[model samples]
Target: MKYPKIRELKEAIVSLLTPAYTSKFPAEPHVPFEKFRGKPSVDDENCVGCETCANVCPSHAITFTDDKEKGIRTIIRDYGKCIFCGQCEEHCITKKGVILSDKIYDMAVFDRSKSIEYQEKELLICQSCNAIITTREHLHFMHRKLGPKAFSSILNLNILNQKLRLAEGQDVSVEIKDGLKRKDMFNIICPNCLRVILVKYLSKGV
Candidate 1:
């Protein structure tokens, strides 16, 4: 019948058509939408290690174990549990996109622990003035806030080098000893305090 012939013709045409979907695993990677939620990358220099991301994470994928005495904060990410919800990125206060990075879609490995890697180095604090000197991001942020002139006036080889320089035989180190402590002081002292500090230091010829 005519119906049988039409069905046979359709099937023949279908055989000539290309496959609808294909995976880009080995040769190429698939592109995600611009807003796609992926892995979180910390700009440790910018990150004060506030542990805000860890506290806000619904999945508990982020962990921060800070040693206040040492002024060291360790950040750990569990990729396996991360929902990629972008909560961390949203909460970061730094304007430099601290929690920003693309997810490796094809990042599969035998050991799950290896998938999580630490991107930041140990945040070394200034032992003398309790200022953040090691992190380029922190220094950049400070410079931006104070302006170039003030930055140069306040920070020179002498001041910069003295950040971690402790007065020998002192009972207690002069450094802040923790990012949280610095942040607390930061809350109390805004741009006004910075201006005042710069003016005072410049007048004293420090």
Candidate 2:
């Protein structure tokens, strides 16, 4: 067999004399090195469930399911499928929604389900056609980002109705009259329904 070069032999000797070059994970708690990108830690309070992470995840570790009937958006984050590329954290719209927890590097688990997590956000379904507008939190995030300009769109005002109960006693039920009327424009409506209303009004020229 060919012998190791002088430099290689010297390196082997030095490595042998040195303590373990790796962390004693099982025996001792793992101490991740600086700038270590580990498992993603979600902040529910900050996560708007906008599907940004799910869209950017290269490995499809994050996924979302919308239930229009229930008006809920479910987000599933499977750490078992995560490559820990830190894309979720890097592209988070809220900037603090998903963060890489350097301390949570060890994700070894027998049950894959144990490594999966779920989050739910209230979805804003269009009252006219039952179409999904977006998550309420995502709309709120948009409002914060757009500031005063967001009020230009009646859709943005949906949040006020939720908090102020502006139409609590009004008979603005979305029973889908012959066609969507102007009265339903203020309600949480999809762009398609709103377009119909706008066109109907502009056509009348009254």
Candidate 3:
């Protein structure tokens, strides 16, 4: 049989003497590289409980629960189901609310509950229907972004007129208008109630 090449024999000997490439995890820490997409984390101080993260999560790792009686909304994030895709960070309206860190990979736990995180915020109830509309923080943020015009659409004509007058430092009595109207303004009314109101207005042909 032909003898192995001298280079091959030398390489084999060197490999045997060299240290193993496998990491000694748990015994020694491992530092991930830059831009590594590891476990997701959130800044509760910056989070407004908008549910945007839950909506964008592809793996269903994020879920939201609303307590209508208590007017509370809870957002839960299960790390056990997270794929570390960073979609939550990408869609977070408040950039500091959610982010993917490079160093939080050691998320092993004996109990599934240990791997879950949650945050809760108070919800805003509709004034007329008493339905859970959204978080108070979300409403405030939208109002700040959209200005006083925010409530002009959903509020009835009387309410809208009063709101406008109050905002403009004027006083006026509420006068109800019995006609359909459309104006480009924002409102806190939930989609369902808005739909019903819209249908009623349209049927009146005004």
Per-model C-alpha RMSD: 8.6, 2.9, 6.9
Task: Please list all clashing residue pairs in model 2, or write none if there are none.
Answer: none
**Each model's TM-score?**
0.52, 0.88, 0.69
Compose the digit string of candidate 3's lDDT tens values, residues 127-194.
33567767877765666667767856454433445435643543221221343234211233455656
lDDT values for all models: 0.56, 0.86, 0.73
Residue runs of model 1 more than 4 Å from their true location after superposition? 1-16, 68-71, 102-104, 119-171, 174-206
Q: Going through the candidates in order, what is the number of backbone clashes in each?
A: 1, 0, 1
Which residue runs does candidate 3 get wrong by more than 4 Å?
1-12, 147-206
Query: Which pairs of residues clash in candidate 3, taking residues 3 or more apart in a chain or in different chains?
Result: 150-186
RMSD of 3: 6.9
Estimate, for each residue in 108-127, the C-alpha lDDT of model 2 and write its tens digit.
78888999999999998877
29: Cα error in model 3, Å? 2.1
Model 1 weakest 10-residue run by lDDT: 180-189
Q: Between 2 and 3, whose TM-score is larger?
A: 2
